[model samples]
Target: MPGDAARPHQASLPPAPRNGLVPSLERRRLQAYLLFVAMDGFILLASFSAIAAAYLGPGGDFAGVRQGAEPAFLLLPLFLTIALYNGTYSRAGLTDWRQAGAKAIAALAISAALLNFFAFFAKMNAEFSRVVFTAGIVLTGAVIVAMRRFLARRLTARWGRGAVNRLVIQAGGPKFSLPDSIHIDAREHGLRPDRADPASLNRLSQYLRNMDQIVVSSSRENRAAWAEVLKGTGLHGEVIDEATRAIGAVGVVKHDDIGMSSLLVSNGHLGLRARAMKRVFDLTISLAALIALSPVMMLTAAAIKLQDGGPIFFRQRRMGRGNGFFAIYKFRSMREDDSDGARSASRDDERITPVGRFIRRTSIDELPQLINVVKGDMSLVGPRPHALGSRAGEKLFWQVDRKYWQRHGLRPGITGLAQVRGFRGATDTEGDLSSRLDADLEYLNGWSLMRDVRILLRTVTVLVHERAF
Candidate 1:
């Protein structure tokens, strides 16, 4: 089983209907988003260049604005960051030309004000031509608005209001349907919400990979199970139930057209704007940390090789976002022959080499996971991922508490509230795991960028702990 290539539930989903329109549409929308960003950036640069050239006479050296052009680079990133949060390039913005235009203009205005404020405070306002820069901002706004209108018209002509892919599953509870949605009979597809079976979960994931929204119509007994399945998929999920309001549903979505209402159970932990911000933050921090710590990582790798001539990095499968599995990387610290990841290392373990012991003490062994963060398998701050065979005392992790599965609603992090609160080291007792799980769930309930920054800063204090071995 150690090297088994096949998963327990390895059957692929039935071939998609409509010639794979679901996946193709998903790809097109993503490409459109990227295209919008690229065009906006180009418009900004071109508008600024033209304005700068026209502002100065022909006899004037065009090379003089080189210093002035530096501001454009700074402004571009700032504007794009603001636009991301303002929904200028979001899915909704892409389909609605008027909304997109409004958001783009607002983001441009805010970015310009912020840039001017920073330039004034830093005593760099005189570094660029204010007249040309101001004119360029106005020109960029006009061009962006027109471009969005044209693109949105084209998209609407093809996909109409339902630009997203929606899936409706009938599972023997009630008859529910939506316009322009792909309807599937779960029985026909061999789909059932068997939470205990990885194969069942994988089959469900395949159907949900590109879906924007899903509505499941199932019997009362199966609604809860189906809800759990949907939560792990990280999509907008709902279940048909008229009594949902009385049972404390998160919210309700009423469909006036079909005269039916569903209980909105799960929408992941973050919205589109929040997810975009977190992703940008993760990439920026991970890339910078990788660059700054390259020398230390190199030395550690050399020492690892010089000690036992084993692999410098250890790779193991860990449960990631959506309860999926991804290979996690770590600096090898245990003896090569004794490197069984299914077993947890104990304090004062003889299997650890001298360099390994030192690196583990200083937490340098976790540096390799920065690569995981960059690969989108992990975040900079959230719940920490555990090995598949991890245990809390004599029982496996999930067996100890049913609520354990709920923690995967968000992406796992390199360092989280548990690690910052000194909850690191081995999990020898159930209480140790419970305390960390409590922290993890609390983090999921409430997440903010500021909280992540504070937790990261606090992690510095617990880098070296007695429990670490």
Candidate 2:
């Protein structure tokens, strides 16, 4: 609700041709995820049995074999974790067998390395069977990946024939060229995802009772307004664009809709592996920082209470990852009676008490944001959170650039490239926000753990500024 407009009224979409190959993969994605886990478990068990038989021989101790296979269960979690870690599982039905197997194999190699690393730490490497580790895991990974591919082909083909959800794309005008094959393919599968007119969206519910998806071409007018309107309809909305860079950053699958290669402009961000790694990083740092800095925080809390008996923490509704609104916390650096919580603080503001100025200057006021990182509302290093009334001059933040909101692709952070570049305070010029936007987009496109670490380390030296500090 902070600088954003109220949700638009629900509009009925125009009548659309409902023909798709299976419902949109969005609805059935979870079912396929579970299936892969099961298939992997089966394949791993079978491969282990074969390897065990050869290693133990036909007459070797039968009871020992059963107990021996018990340790192999550890490999199941490892397999699943590695599969998830590398995105072999999360990106289900989006890739072909070759790509899937390649990713799976890479995951297998990493899992093997992890197994050895843990084994070495536990001093179990000597007792662990090397032959089974190499041969059995290799065999298991091959069979599972191949089986995974076969199942993907089979399920997609099988489900493609059944009745599925309908997707209707509305282009601004009729001049856009769309392929008839798109309608034909959907018709063949009993789904009706065809091109429609954006003007008649007010009648969407009347024409298509079971419409599951509403897609908008990038060329559509007032995209934000239309998106908000459709949001009230309770159907998932996607903006399909031909721009590869914009699409690739947000889209998970490159869908050839009609005759055009369209990108699904949502579900973009750090993939499964990166998110998992970042979460681990967030927890490690947040918990450690909280423990190490408890005394400092306690003193700050007391100082604020004694200063004017005001609340120590200031919580504001700020935008987060996925364009979601969350309460961002900070040690209050303004007077408790300041009614304009949404406004940016001017240099030498009267609302800032003496203690507030020092904390803000030293960058200690933002330290409480570590709680946001641990709570998963933010990351340790990212685009800084902006208040609802956050603006560049008279215009609100999102209004400055069409792609500005894309900065929400990652969670907001306490400090970022923009801050280190000295663009942290009030933005009076358009160029100032653009400079910050450039840094944000740059961080997103080339994000890495090392880059995150470097940014975090770099943040310490630049936390204090002459003017703002």
Leading candidate by lDDT: 1
The global C-alpha lDDT for each of the candidates, from Candidate 1 onward, is 0.80, 0.63
lDDT of 2 by residue, 1-469 (tens): 1102222333422234333233344445556667777877787777776777678888868665654454467677886788876777654433356666877788777777887888899998776667766777888888977786787677656444222344444434222333221222212222221112212322333333333444545343334443433333334455554444423323433445444444344433565457668889988988999999899889998998899998999987776654546788888888853332446677768889888998888888988999998888888988887766666877777677756656766778777888887777668778888999999888877889988898888888877876573
Off by over 4 Å in 1: 1-21, 24-90, 96-153, 185-192, 198-203, 245-248, 336-342
lDDT at residue 35 of model 2 (Cα atoms): 74
**What lDDT is reached at residue 113 by model 2?**
82
TM-score of every prediction relative to native: 0.71, 0.63
lDDT, candidate 1, 284-347, per-residue tens: 9999999999999999999999988989998877777766667889899988533225567788
